[model samples]
Target: MTAYTATVTVRLKRGVLDPEAETTKRALSRLGFELEGLRSTDRYEVDLDAESADAAAARAEEMAERLLANPTIHDYEVSVEER
Candidate 1:
């Protein structure tokens, strides 16, 4: 089996209410962050044994679509890496 590295970024889907992000943005603005279009997110990097990058990416997508993200409100992106 070939060793593969998977990286995923998870975020609230568009049109979903992000209370945490809003609260954080308010706090940041209070602190003079002067930012716009604030967004909150999570990221993960997983190492696995797979035959190819395409396979790894497919598996990662399934994992995200099934477990890592909420289809109604969350979204994710996956990428496979060498080494």
Candidate 2:
């Protein structure tokens, strides 16, 4: 098996209300950051082991879909780099 680094990005779906994101945006704006059109996102870095890069990526995708992201309300993307 090969070790890999998984980069996972999670975001609210378009047209969905992301209260956490919105709150952050407002906070940034209050802090004098002009974030009128800013959107918020979350990222995670994970280390995993698999037979191949493809397999690692598939596993990351599955992990996001099943645990990290809400399929009905969020969008998720994952990339894996073999080590």
- The best candidate by lDDT is 1
lDDT of 2 by residue, 1-83 (tens): 99999999999889998777778888888899975576788898889989998888888899898899889988998988876
Computed on alpha carbons, the lDDT of every model, listed in order, comes to 0.88, 0.87
Candidate 1 residue runs with Cα over 4 Å from true position: none
Q: Name the TM-score of candidate 2.
A: 0.86
Summed over model 1, clashes come to 0
Q: In model 2, which runs have C-alpha deviations exceeding 4 angstroms? A: none
**In candidate 1, which residue pairs clash?**
none
Tens digits of per-residue lDDT, candidate 1, 30-79, equal 99888886888988888988988999999989889888888888889998
lDDT of 1 at 52: 89
Using TM-score as the measure, the top candidate is 1
